[model samples]
Target: MHDFIDHNLLARLSALPLESRQAMIGSVAGKHRSPHRGSSVEFAEYRKYVPGDDTRRLDWKAFARSDRFYIKEFEADTNLRAYFVVDSSGSMNFASGETDTKIQYARRIAASLSYLLVKQGDAAGLSVCNDKIHLEIPPSRSASQLQHIFNSLGELEPKGETGLVEALHTVAEKIKQRALVVILSDLFCDPEELGDALQHLRYRKHDIAIFHLLDRQEIDFAFDRPHRFVDLEDNSTLVAEPNLIVDEYHAALNEYLTKVEAKAHDAQADYQRIVTDQDYEAILSDFLTNRLR
Candidate 1:
């Protein structure tokens, strides 16, 4: 098992089924609802019978009530194909104290989720994005696919300026079918640009889930003395007295968070803002449980 795959966490979450909020279009019969009508037990809706419709699907009760022919439609069940988009930007290397680096945490989440998806007969894939989309593994249901994804995640490292926004746009254009697109990143890009990229995925009918990873120190700015902060992406340096700029820093952080949240809401993406100090298990558990609702 890879270091990112927590056996205990996997065991605990194994019973919680991963599900999609929207209907998917897949190639095989499975657990999730599909766009096309099929002979599933769950009732969808009824429509007036068409000449070429299956006669067995006709609802005699509906006919008796309205004196007109109607066809009973049931939701078609199909497999889900998911793509875990992980950011390998330089900013993702940050880790305060003993907590895992943002990129490491992302690896854990992506690997764990892909394991669960494949275990339940769904297809899972990976996209490692940094200055560009460095690698892309197409979704696959084969058991060996999990190992392949794990290997890719294990070798990934964070470097260079973030190109997450452009990478997302490319993903939106590349994926031809509806899929669950899970994103794990610090999301250090312009909120407006991020919003546009998210909207592109939404417009393509892909279900979006975002995990905005941040470190506690980055959020708290607890440094009491003057410190030199280096830009991980561009190698720029800033020497500032925390006392002098704490207020402005906080204000800017708050404004950024507000805009990001609003954009995510507007796109209807499932977004989770996480501090690195928190347990990833708890984070994932909450995410899985909420989708069950």
Candidate 2:
């Protein structure tokens, strides 16, 4: 991770109005559609008149014009609900250089997104999880609530094995309404397990986006000197020469990432590979553009 300041990034992001940001995303995302329904001007389906139906829905203009009563119908407009799932596992605490830790990057991303959602009057919530959910905030459209979410994200300290699958399953069971589920994690776990968990969310009709966060050092195998690599989650250590294993390690890593991406696509979800070394704004802009498309 790089030494990018959170406040700086937040300030830059704040410049874009919430509606503009959402509209930018809306332009790219084929999944999101206008949710309005009415008979005023827009056309919707016509249903047989039932008792207790609103009389205003009746096409009185059509009836007087045609001598028959027909209900005008229009699509219903609805606000989007978004849930941000942050991985607080031990591996997310890793920072090999001047960059912030993965956890820090994840928090900034979560905060920016939550800010956007709440600003647009959409419901947004946060969930921090390791092996299980450590904190859960229900969806809300309050600025104060968003501040609390930012505070909670800022205070988090990562420490524990990843139970990504378990945590997601728990969340899937808890949320009753459909929502957009955004996952921010390093994703150092079994691919099959992760896929299964994501499938569960998709099955419930939730839109999903996976942000696979990682350090550039981890991806490029840039460690020059021989060193002991430690697995933060299991506390296991292994001595290795990067020059000797770099090629094999990268091959395996790429294969794993490919599998994850393929699975997400199959499940009708968006998958983005985010490097903590890059500018956060660029990554977010790309994501929104892709979403709107």
Candidate 3:
């Protein structure tokens, strides 16, 4: 048990397994649909019988009617391999008021999901990305893997500029097998660039889930008087009166958000915009429940 994991919350979520939205290819027999045919009870489809085909799988009744040998294929059940990519950029260190930092919020989400995934007999991995991907933990179903993921999450410190786009591209190329890529970040990079990265993952046939982490302050910009704003990614600062430029600021923010969301939709990724102020348990519950639907 780690600080990021709440035992009571884990108990509540234990019944809800983490499911994949698409068929997967795994090395074990478990839940979820797989592209490969196996001996599962669920019927898939019939195919023309070929040489070396298993005789036990032959449908004799179909052959008797059609005068051609056919083999019955049953849907294969496989486990899911999930990669949790957490953005460790300086912006992730931001928290408005008493709210948790973006990285802190992300840690809870990633750690909790990892626990559920492994507990349900799936595999889980971790990647912490800032200017570059700094850490990589390959997916594993071993029960002890949960502690490895938790330790990595607990030790993360947000710093440097974001290289999320590059990190995603790397993931798409590195993970030869299909997997569920769960990304948690503020997504400060260009939306178009991010779209290309996501498209790469889509092209590779990997399922993508993006949690666009944001602080309420970043969205509301509710400063009452003149304030000095600093860029967390860089050592840059700007002094401005909130009343004077609020409209322009909001316009820019709205445009950026729209583009990012549109890009996510274009890539067919499961996208969730999260405000750090919200309860993480509720957010994850909704996410897990929606997948069941």
Candidate 4:
């Protein structure tokens, strides 16, 4: 599709619900990592067979080898609580087309995810921020929360400098329970600081997924003629020739992007760079499939 968001997108995503990679602290039963193993379909671990243990759960294959009774334990699944943290900084306004701003792309993805999670009978929340967190909604599984999330996303506009590092730390403290924290941003911030922010979340034991939103032109440096490049955040302007700076720009951008990706992996976070022109539905489906694994 030419656009990232479509009315029918949520219907497609409904078949593939969002799940957490780590044990989530949710009140309701759903599909994800759980603290205790039960009758869930996923396999967890094994334990010594006790006198009162169900014979059906006994592993005869292990008994044949060890000559001891061992009970097969399967992982327990629970409903996931997910929070969508979206960047509303000026740089998110970068788009080759009039209607496809980076922030718009991010909002669409966040809304879709929220819909999928809610449809799966899980909790979902929203956080919109730039230099500071503008809005924060606690996770809830209520059916009505979905419309509120979409309305909030529709009303917000990207502005101000990025405060991703600070904003991340702030949100981390707000979420007391373990959850799936999805961040949608252009990530125009200090590399080391962003790493620390991720580390903070990891320290709190939250599973993180980063959707690094970017316009294709930003990576390609494909401005046809020399024009004034204005800094969206600072109101500063730089006059340069694309032919002369393309090589240098690409080199620097590549190095920076590489560092961000490496840092995300180092912190054990799932990072995906989403170009504005790509199909977001396929990207999200792949991500959800991997999470199910």
CA lDDT, every prediction?
Answer: 0.94, 0.77, 0.94, 0.86
TM-score winner: 1
Model 2 Cα lDDT, one tens digit per residue, 157-270: 898899788988988888876678899999888888888888998887678888999998888888788999898988999999998988999999899989888878877778
- lDDT by residue (214-290, candidate 3, tens digit) is 99999999999999999999868999999999999999999999999999999899999999999999999999999
Q: Per-residue lDDT for 107-153 in model 4, tens only?
A: 77888888788888888999889889999888888888977888888
Model 2: runs farther than 4 Å from truth? 1-73
lDDT per residue as tens, model 1, 21-85: 99999998899989998889989999999899989999999999999999999999999999999
- Each model's backbone clash number: 0, 19, 0, 1
Badly placed stretches (over 4 Å) of model 4 are: 1-5, 50-67
RMSD in order of candidates: 1.1, 5.5, 2.0, 2.6
Count clashing pairs, candidate 4: 1
